[model samples]
Target: MKVGVLVLAFILAFFAESLPLGPLYAQLHPDFVALLILYWALSSSQVLSYFGIWLIGLVQDLVLGDLPGSQAISLVLMLALLYGWISRVRHLPSWEQLFFVFFLLLAQCLSAWLWHAWVGPIRWHSSLLLGPALGAALWPLLTYLLDQLQKHWPRRKTP
Candidate 1:
C-alpha cells in the first residue's frame, strides 16, 4: 500500500500540473506535488527518500519544461533539511509536523529564485513568491488529509 500511496501522490502531482493555467497571470503557480513530497519525506522518511524526491522532481521538471536538475536539487535539499529536523524531535506536534513542510516550500521558492538569478534580467516578480507561500500555507490541510488517508487505508503488512 505504500507503493499505492506513492503512485497516487505522483498521479496527483501529474494532474495538478497537467492542467492549463489561465491567461491572467501565474506568479502564484503552486507546486502541488512538491508540497506533498516534502510532507511525506518529513513525516515518513522510510517511505520517501532522496531518490524518490529526485525522481518526482525530474518528472516535474520534464512536465513543466524547466531545467532538469533544478527541482531535483531543490527537493533533495528540502528532504534533507526535514530529515535532519525530524530526527531531532522527540515529542513533535502535528503543528510542528506541518511547519517543516512550510519551511521547505519557502526554501524551494528561494532556490527557484536563485536559479533564475543566474539567468539574465530576472523578472523579480513579487508574485513569484506566492506559489511557495501558498504551498506552505496549505500544509496543515495537506497534513490532515494525509493523516486521514494513512489512518483509514489498509497498508500492506510488513514482514
Candidate 2:
C-alpha cells in the first residue's frame, strides 16, 4: 500500500510537471518528481532505494523525451548524496531540514543543467535557480501531506 501511494504520487507529479503553463511559468516550474524523490529518500530510504530512483528517472526521461539515461543518472546521484547524509539530516529541525533540502534541489538542478549543456546547446538561465527555490518552498507542504498519508496507510500484519 505504501508503494502504491508512492508510485501514484510520482505519476501525478510527473503529469503535473508536464502541464502547459505558458513559456515563463513552464520554465520556472519546480521539478516535483525530483522533490518527491528527495522526500522519499529522506523519509523512507529503506523502501525507496537507488534502483527505484533510477527507474523513476528513466520514467521521467521517457515522459519528457530526453536522453535515455540522463534523469536516471541525476536521480541516482541525488540518492547517493541523500544516502550519505540522511542519518544526520533526520535529526535536524524543520528549518534546517528545509535548508538541506534546498541544497539537494540545487545540486539536482545543477547536475541536470550540466548534463543538458554537455549533450545539447550551452544555454544558461536564471530559471535554473528558480526550480530549486520553488522546490524548497513547497517542501514543507509536501512533507506534511505525505506524512499524513503515511500515517493512515494500512499496517502489515506480523507473521
Candidate 3:
C-alpha cells in the first residue's frame, strides 16, 4: 500500500510537471519529481533502492525529454547526499529542514547543469535557482500533506 501510494504520487508529480504552462510559468515551475525523491529519501528510505532512484530519474528524463541518464545521475547524486545526513536532518525543525532540502535541490540543479555543460554548451537560466527555491518553499506543505496521508494508512501489527 505504501509502495502504491508512492508510485501514484510520482506519476501525478510527473504529470503535474509536464503540464503545458507556457514559457514563463514553465521556467518557474518546480521540479516535483526531485521534491518527491527528497521527501521519500528522508521519510521512507527503505522503500526505494538506489536502482529504483536511478530508474525514477530515467523515467523523469524520458518524460521531460532531457538528455538520457542525466536526471538519473542527478537524482542518484541527490540520494547519496541525503543518505548521509537524513538521520540528523530529519530531526530538525521544519524551518531548518527547509535549508537542508534547499541545499539538496540546489546540488541536484548544479549536478544537472554540470552534466549538461560537460555534454555540450550550457545556457544558464534563472529558473535553475527559481525552481529549487520554490521546491524548498513547498517542502513544508508537502511534508504536512504526505504526513497526513501516511497517518491515514493502515498499519500492520507486529507479532
Candidate 4:
C-alpha cells in the first residue's frame, strides 16, 4: 500500500515536473517529483527513504535524458540538506517553508549546472536557471496542494 501511494505520487510529480513552460522556465522549475518525494519522505514513515530517493532520482535522470544517478546524487544532497534543517527548525510557517523550497530549487539547478560543466556542455539550458526563480514563486501554492493531499489521502501504514 505504501508502495502504491508512492507510485501515485511519482506519477503526479512526473506531470508536475514536465509542465512545458516556456524555454526560459525549464531550468528554474522546481522539481515537483523531488519536492513531493522529499516532503512525504520526511513527513511520513510510510513514504520512501534514501533508497527510494535514489531510485526516483535515477528515473528522473532518465526522464530528462541525462545520465543515470545524476538526480540520485542530487536527491542525496537534497535529503541531507533537508535533514540538517529539520533538526534545527520548529513550527515553521508557510512563508519560511516556501523560502526553504526556493533555496532547494537553486541547489538542484546548481547540481545540474555542475553536471554539465564536468561531463559536457548541455546546450539550451538557460531555462533551468529561470526555473528556480519561477519555482520559488510557485512554492506556496504547490506546498498547500501537497499538504492537502497528505491530509486527505494520508497514506496508511501497513506492517
- Model 1, position 94, has a per-residue lDDT of 56
Each prediction's total of clashing residue pairs, residues at least 3 apart in sequence or on different chains, is 0, 0, 0, 8
TM-scores, in order shown?
A: 0.81, 0.89, 0.90, 0.77
Q: Which residue window of length 10 is worst by lDDT in model 2?
A: 41-50
lDDT of 4 by residue, 28-120 (tens): 556777667546644564534678678888888877777767778777777767777764432476566767766776687677567767787
What lDDT score goes with residue 85 in model 1? Answer: 69
Give the alpha carbon lDDT tens digit for every residue of 10-52 in model 1.
7887787667776323457667888777666656646455786
Q: What residue pairs are clashing in model 4?
A: 27-127, 27-128, 27-131, 28-128, 28-130, 28-131, 28-132, 29-131
Predictions ranked by TM-score, top down?
A: 3, 2, 1, 4
- Per-residue lDDT over 94-152 for candidate 3, one digit per residue giving the tens place of the 0 to 100 score: 66798989999989988988999999998998789988899999999988887787778
TM-score between candidate 4 and the true structure: 0.77
Worst 10 residues of 4 by lDDT: 86-95
lDDT of each: 0.70, 0.81, 0.85, 0.68
Q: Which candidate is the best by TM-score?
A: 3
Better of 2 and 4 by TM-score: 2
- TM-score of decoy 3: 0.90
